[model samples]
Target: MSYSNAQELLSAIQPASGGTEIFDPATGELVGRVAQNSVADLDAAVSAARTAQPAWDALGHEERNRLLNLAADRIEANAEALAELLSREQGKPLNGPNARFEIGGCAAWLRAATAYEVEPEVVVDDGETYAAKHYRALGVVGAIGPWNWPMMISIWQLAPSLRMGNTVVMKPSEYTPLSVLALGHVLNEVLPADVLQVVAGGREVGEKLSGHPEINKIMFTGSTPTGKAIIRSSADTVKRLTLELGGNDAGIVMEDADPKAIAEDLFWGAFINTGQTCAALKRLYVPESIYTQVCQALTEVAAKMPMGVGLDENNVLGPLQNKAQYNIVADLVQGAVDSGATVLLGANPDSEAAGYFYPTTLVADIDPQNDLVTKEQFGPALPIVKVKNVEEAITHANSLETGLGASVWGSDREQALAVAARIQAGTVWINSHGTIDPRIPFGGAKQSGYGLEFGLDGLKALAQPQLIKG
Candidate 1:
């Protein structure tokens, strides 16, 4: 079987089509079908997770770390297969620059989680009482993931939670659930039965997982609206929650920065992964001094890139993963054009042939208050807003409802640092965007959602602290 769809994968377990369809956007071919998960299935996965969690949690740090490392090794060994599944299902360029890196990064995160050297610092003062703090796991985490990067996102949800000793019941986006199923197969080989189960279905499946009495924690990465709903449902249990929601990140190019360097940062931040990244640059604010030059340079760069399969090994761009997103990108771009925004570079869907792919688009004259600037495009559409000064750029970037990540471009390290301090996002890059490493803590400051993932801190988010005093 070539990993067609969720239903096909589930066929080995049960009989039913489940009413979900999976297609390859590049070819519009039905890759797989999924069985709609029912309430019974939810109960089963949760029960299995709950039953196995205690023993898994009982293992020492070394034992747990070993298991996690094993998973990372497997992922590294199968990077190509994983990347192909990811690109085929998500419609990203095959073997794209970032896809495989993301997989490798997942492996790195696992090792980092294992090697986190955090010892409880004991305080010995004049009148100090002895106390030692320790962190422990919250069993049975319910993870609701998005479709953009299913494998990496699933690893994001699993690596730390499992490292911390919590079991997982993941409900991936319906459109791209097959990758999760594929992931589950890899996990089952190393993990005990029921430690990590991919529960298929839709909103109802997620609802059961979030509201299930057995679930101890809920970690979700998806749209802001969906995130809010998950929070509301988890309130009854107050299930330990971690959310990495949508982002409308901005790139600020200061007047002092090199236009060539700034344009390169803008291009990758706004166009990589077909610009479907949650934290990829969606809004760009350029210094007025070099606006035209920057725009021309960005246009030239965008034009040279090709779109194709994420597994094709040669294609650099790919079609949008779904129809709804294609429409969203189209509407936002067309709206910008209708409002007198200049098409620095791009093809209007109205003028294009077919498929869900959009050209690397550059839209200028976009008001800071416009919908295109304020919303998460989640596509390869760049809306540049030229600002008079860094102060205005900072002001506008902080206005959005999401704040996952942002980039600041300039040569003055101190000045860029000072400007970066003012930006409301949690992760700010001085001269780069979408450059994440396992050694750092990653999360959003505002509505981009709470709870951190990656690094020693990432594992800590899944742990509970207990003070042991003598």
Candidate 2:
């Protein structure tokens, strides 16, 4: 899929923006170029949205449901191509799996949101009914998504906002903007262009869109520091905000744990997406009894994963999106080594041929207060801290500034659930890591960011109630 001609690339994109550069993670090749939105492009999109919105919104729930559902159908049709393109741009191992997960999950959200009952019922006082309640949309929602899972996150934003009757202007991360832009073109075919619009470019473009006065709300997913900055920027306008930030989630392994199974769970959970997830199980606390066995089992599993291009079926991991992440992961690994933490397996990634890849590293015996354990290292490096008992594991796991998600691994489900209950996070998985659901709400606790993205909880976030006197 080479775009030798500029016009061919131009036609592929719906609302093209300049300064967009595409790189093949496999060969580090220049795969494509994109023209980002100039001020004129932004004007056109916003005006088009402003024009199309009132009518789209006026059509009300039934029409909106039909249009959004059609958009979901279109997403299904393009699933394969989108997956391959997403892998080429962002470099996740399960290009096929990830793509399928995102598409299916997005459709589910649209379907769920369609059934959202925003009508008012009865909540009375004294002798007679004082007022009635109803929910209203928040106008245009400014959704800014991350590169790790752009398509899904965009749907995370779009599903709720559209259901609530607000129009959307989504700005995807510059590193992986193509799939999102392509979505805009697809939706235009199924639904009106105003319902879902994808606006792409670099940080400057994002800042402009996020700060636009017309935008009533902003939903973002990224690092805590960046989330704070975005909140501050949106503060002047006092935009409605939902920030999904960072996490150094802790996984607790009890003495009663089965070392072999726990080992496999720990590696995949903490190190999935090369350890790039915000809620990915990160710091691990293991009881002394099973420490040696757990370590040995994990070392072998980590060794089996091979890093290469995402398109390769057998590739276990792919490259980091860019050099900055590569350096970040590199330094974290080096720091752990200097802090008396032992690197049990693998080293800094050596990807001389293609993509920014990092080998999975399991570091043990580090002080719990060490930056490697406390800081949010979003990469394929797992650092383990030994704890005397489950109590200490619970305390240490909750010690971080961010609380996104965690896992409690043990043979005893009751014990794991009890320990998981003690850890402070939005979601805690027992005997597993990194499982998310559209029916169940997903978000973070504390600095991990606030607000839910899916399920009935998400519908509430997008809805507002109005009371009328009876």
TM-score of every candidate relative to the true structure: 0.94, 0.92
What is candidate 2's lDDT per residue for 297-336, written digit by digit as tens? Answer: 9998888877777777877677777778878888888888
lDDT of 1 at 271: 78
Worst 10 residues of 2 by lDDT: 1-10
- Measured by TM-score, the strongest candidate is 1
Q: Would you list the C-alpha lDDT of every candidate in the order shown?
A: 0.80, 0.77
Relative to the unseen true structure, what is the Cα RMSD of model 2? Answer: 3.0
Q: Please report the candidate that would top lDDT against the real structure.
A: 1
- Predicted structure 1, TM vs. truth: 0.94
Model 1: runs farther than 4 Å from truth? 1-19, 118-128, 350-354
In model 1, the number of clashes is: 15
